[model samples]
Target: MSGMINLIKMELFRLVKSKGTYLTILFVVIFSFLLFMMSSSFGEQSKANMLEEDNALYAEITEEEEHIKSGGIGFVGVDFTRDTDIKFETIVHSFLSSGVFLIFCGIFAANTVCNKYKCGFQKNLSTYSNKKWQLTASENIAVLAFTVTEILLIVFILLIISVFYFENFRLGSAANIIKYMGMQAVLYYAFATLIMFIVEVVHSKVAGITVTCLLSMGFGSFFFNKLDEILKLNNFLVTQHTIVYNAKMLPIAFDGELWGTAATVAICSIILYNIFSAFFVSSRDMA
Candidate 1:
């Protein structure tokens, strides 16, 4: 265990030196803040338009009170702030579940593994006294990378909240954000394992990274939707399962079905990846 811990520390050190790893975090943070600002601006524009429409409608209603008095087509002011409780929850959710962001996560996973292979780190590690300890350390390193990504993500999210809606913040909602980020970390850990499996099987960085991009970018969704149309296997897709889980993690009423599906998919993905990786890494040439 001590050896594995030491290896993890070394892996982290190597990760920091890998410029691509930091690029991933940089991209996620910059794009997340951009999206937040754009969405907030759009929301303000929409609110102004809605307010204008409300005034016009109210004038029409006063001029035509007989219709409203007949209990038909009454105008209540549009509640622009109707869903304010879920505002911050939504900003975090939308950014996390965005197709572009997910693809970046996939790229990050693939690149982390690719870097090890390209730099001959994996081959050297395979020569260690206990191969299992080395592999475990590597996987733990990927997990840690994903955890760090989640931390950066949450920090950016809260930064946005602080800028725009700090007054509306409640401890309960903040707790929910933390909980959702925890779920995201778990999902990303599974994803990193799957990417490692891909990297191992393909034996080429380009192919592995391309496959990761394809899977996370909703091409998988298109194929799976077609399959579901023909055979109803929607729940079996890991990407879809994660999307469902992310959507359900919002500050709203909980749905057992969504959480169950997400949990099942996460567990199955981890188990299957570990099993495949154990066999593939052990039997394949490390050269």
Candidate 2:
């Protein structure tokens, strides 16, 4: 236990000192900012158009009222107002459902794992430690920490930007946001572990990044969906049972069924990937 903890500590320190870590965070921030800005601009334009229509209708109604008072026939149209309130939960859902978050985090995880090999860190660690699985375990924990950090940072930045950009901004239910974010965090960790597993198996940075990027972008799910369409295996869709699919389809309002499905997928992925990663790490020659 002490050795595992020490290994975890070393992994965290290495992650902190790594330049790629900062670069990943920077890229996430920039991408998130740009996304929010574009959404905000589009929202503003929509609201402006709605307000203009509302004003024009109001003016026409006032004129009709005057005409009716003067004993002239005038029909006043029914007033319709659109709800343009942008909720915090909506922003979070949009961000998560886009799959961009997973892509960024997966790339970071792949880079972190592959860099260990490039820098000879994995070789040294394996040389000193008989239990090679501990290194994989430690890397998993560190990646989980980085995933959580990214989640919090993205949420914080979005919330701050929403406050400034949204006139009718609402936070919606606190409980719902918490539940949604909690599940997403689990899925993110699962994704990171899966990336680590892939990196361990491929043992190449380029392959790791390429495969993770494709997977994160939903290519894996797309292929699975197509296979399901072709096979029609008892009407069971494999894509629906995948982590990437669940993460992309997760709703802001928690439904027990969907939430359970997502939790199951994420938990299974985390366990299976970590087991495979540990086995690969232990069985492979680091020399």
Q: Candidate 2 lDDT, tens digit per residue, 209-273?
A: 78777776656865886888898988477878888778777787979988999999999999999
Off by over 4 Å in 2: 44-83
- Compared with the true structure, what per-residue lDDT tens digits does model 1 show for residues 216-281? 544555565566577766446433554423422322223577655655676677778878876776
Steric collisions counted per model:
0, 0
Model 2 per-residue lDDT at 90: 71
Best by lDDT: 2
Ten-residue segment with the worst summed lDDT in candidate 1? 70-79
Q: Rate the local accuracy (lDDT) of all candidates.
A: 0.57, 0.77
- Candidate 1's C-alpha runs over 4 A off are 48-86, 129-133, 155-157, 164-172, 233-254
TM-score of model 1 vs. true structure:
0.73
- The TM-score leader among the candidates is 2
